[model samples]
Target: MSDINNWVLPEGIEELLPDEALRLEKIRRDLIDLFASWGYQFVIPPLIEFLDSLLAGTNSELALQTFKLTDQISGKTLGIRADMTPQIARMAAHHIKKCDAPVRLSYLGTVLHARGAQIEKSRSPIQLGAELYGSQHIKSDVEIIQLMLEVLAVSAIQHVHLDLGHVGVYRGLAQQAGLTTSQEGELLDVLQRKSSDEVVELLETYKLDKKWVNVFVQLLQLNGDVTVLEQAKKVLKLGDASVQQAIEELQEIAALLQQSYPSLPLYFDLAELRCYRYQTGVVFAAFVPGFGSEIARGGRYDNLMIEQGEQVRSATGFSADLKVLTRLMAVILDEQAKEIILAPDVLDENLQGLIRELRTAGKTVIMQLPDSSKQPNHTALIAKVNDKWSVS
Candidate 1:
């Protein structure tokens, strides 16, 4: 007998069944092709990186999730990537050239990590996304958002909401609060989680002004309708060059995107904001039902090029968690039911030929079709053609 202990797979990891696997494969093909249609080039970055490279002042929450160990050859701390954005930024900075202007990239692959789940989720996830580098135009931001929606539209995920924010908004608010960096970070964490009480406590503890405090609390509750932008000025008074200017940025992006995705919902949350130090402009999180975490997330980072010492430019992008997308919406996926070509009484040559032809054409072809004779209720589309060939 096989030793069960030796054969057991690790917890939180899963095997994709044939049907599930095929569905995911189709999802990938569809999305990659969709991205290609928009001139976004395919890029499969290596899944591992020197730990220091990825953690270079990135979100501490993200750094904690990495599956870490020392590299055997380099003797350096190497780790599985928890996020791909930093590497994408690095790749753009290193190669891709100065004149490319807007370098568009797309990728679909597994990202391994430990403690992969966020506050409520408890499973490691497979993430897929695309990035737009260079070009700091607000149009680039709207374009990426439209593309994300298009992917969902094609995939038949109808109810999608993009909760957009300006990273600078809260970061600016943090500056105005006059709290130390550590206090600001803790307050940001509370806001991100939507814990209003924690946010209120922080505002009081920091002794922020009443008007600013009111705006801070309202920012946490910023959600629903583009009309919120119109009301923002009354609620949150701009502090000359700080948080107020950041609010203006979000409102500007909202107006630009609303013309295209007019029904697109907009929101503001001062509490749940972070200075993705690299993210210089608008940031966003995409939510869809069934997936416990953000389905897709990205933002504009105009400083990465300058950070690497280049002429200033801007870009924005997003990554859709293809694994979660396929799994959660399996029922709606066109490929949910396993389809088999129902051919019968055909010679082995013809069957093999058909299978090979379809397989080569990139269709997931099942060798054997369902047999109603053997099972009595098998449902499959049987090819209805006589052996004699006729010219039409």
Candidate 2:
């Protein structure tokens, strides 16, 4: 006898039923249209690639989350993509190199992770995102942020709270303090946890100057509303020039976002170092009231393409799990499932023609089969009236 566990799926993997799949498809089409309206051409990268190319310039976190296997043909290690950013970066560098102007690209595909994120438990997520390449101006960053917010709005996800940060803040301080790579990593680990005690202990253990230690500790508290920017300007005034520049960049981006979305709840976190290993500049993520983790995130990675053996080009974008967005939308939006029509299984050319006509008119027509006891849920049915095919 076959084992009962044969049908069970791996943990964190999932399949969507008919209703959920329909909803997800509809949202996918709508989002792709939205991106197109913004001049973002859609692209589909491969699900797997050479491990080195797939993980190029990405942090160890991504490498840890990737599943690796040997390619029988080439005898080389290949990785199932855990993220699409690196893949897209390579595409921009190698494939779309002829054009010098900024390129806007969007993609929707499934990404498999070896381990799930802290709050999101799914290891297989349908990732949907847009990337803008070849520009590093503050306007480019603001545009990406605006587009991200627009994406959430289109998905009917409400009450979005955006948290903004710049890794340069911490990087600048780490450099000014002359902290070694190992020491910087240790400090970063504690800063991410917001453990002020550990941060002080580590700093004292390193014997850093009081000025650097004070600023480093102050980084942990530089969070909250817009006023935090003013505090940051004064507190980081004595640090590296890049620290001051990062603060200014954040200020400018915030002002633009406020102008475009005056009622948006925006927060700042100086100590936030998301994807710090590759992100060169500003970083941001969106959240909702009950969600314990960010729903979507992206940041500038000016050096990623260079690491791919191509010329340096600035890039920034945002991504979210399409499945998660669809789930959240289901809760917020009223049910408006499409109408499905049932038809008789009789072998009649006229009936077949009518079914075709109905389907052409955007109606879902499911023909019944002979000797079948299965019943389908349909909103309407096709019937014979006056010797003609009609929907009743």
Candidate 3:
């Protein structure tokens, strides 16, 4: 209604100034190149799609975050993407020709969320990620995690703390205990919050055998260093074969990561069910010392393709907010130091040639207008010296 209101952007939405924009672009290009080196082909999915396709294979959390509208042309409900992972899955399943080998794809773009996460309050974030499809092996999971760490390294972020979990662990336990879907969902909620009293109360209400009760309780304390995995194997021995298999998969991946990144901090959390409804297997998130929440996260969603009505395929990937990465980058870009050449208003052919040469050599050149009173800030100036036009 007012001029001020017109300039005010929605909460959690932001615009980048010149310096920040330039730095973000540089980081984006560098990371894209990094993904390319790893044999990941880049993809550019649309910002909006039909609601059903956009929301396919994702959880209710994503659905709540998506902003919906009616498309006048098609008179169909459309949804702006709140997360690109599902779209990436769709592309891999339908667009790309089916191949036996895994399809590696990377994407970078802005995603709109109706509401922001509590820790990071940005509704509009530039999401950058890579996905490996068609492989169910632990090696693929490890590769995705390794690539996530490399992304942090490229952004100059250090001291990353990685938290790993397997949804299969809990899935197996619930199935073995014969808990109903509602009961499992309730338990998952309490476990994620580490609400000990509530967790105990719910398990007591379930009236399970002591072994089932004990294993469920132990899940809360199963978070710590790598040693927690050994404890999990022993405590969860009562679980079915699927439980043991999940633990073994985690162990194998942890061993590989420790061998490759010896100094990386790894924490095991059996109760960490991030993206639980969407993820089918191993889940992981990366955090730094000061950051209160994960800077990047992803997990295995082996059933996503099948749920989308396509052939079965395994998928794993991680996504980070490019805006956050730019903010946390250790190297500060000094845009002011960039050379800017100012050429005087002139009609001489030689002056034009020199301007062209400077521009061709990657210099920013500003030609002076005939009668303009405005003067731009420039780091250098083009002047005639000894009958020759030169930059000083």
Best by TM-score: 3
Give per-residue CA lDDT, model 1, range 1-392, as digits (tens): 88888977566666778767877788788888999999988877788888877665466677777888988999999878877776776777765575565788877777766764654443456666777877666678888888887877666665677787777767766676676888766776777777667778877887788776766678777665666655655565654475567677677777787788777655554344554555777788777765566776777877655554445456578876666677666355445443444445546665566657756876554334345345222235335358532111
Show model 1 residue runs off by greater than 4 Å. Answer: 5-7, 118-124, 193-197, 207-215, 267-270, 274-278, 289-292, 303-313, 330-392
Per-prediction count of colliding residue pairs? Answer: 6, 0, 0
Q: How much is 266 displaced in model 2, in angstroms?
A: 0.3
Candidate 3 TM-score versus the reference = 0.95
**Candidate 3 lDDT, tens digit per residue, 137-252?**
89999999999999999998878889999999999999999999999999999898888778888889989887888789888898898888988999999999999999999999
Model 3 RMSD vs true structure: 1.7
Please list the C-alpha lDDT of all candidates, in the order they appear: 0.68, 0.88, 0.90
77-170 per-residue lDDT for model 2 (tens digits): 9999999888888888875578888999999999999997754478999999998998879999899999999988888899998999999989
Where is the poorest 10-residue window by lDDT in model 2?
Answer: 329-338
> 326 in model 2: Cα distance from truth in Å?
1.2
- Lowest summed lDDT over 10 consecutive residues: which window, candidate 3? 93-102
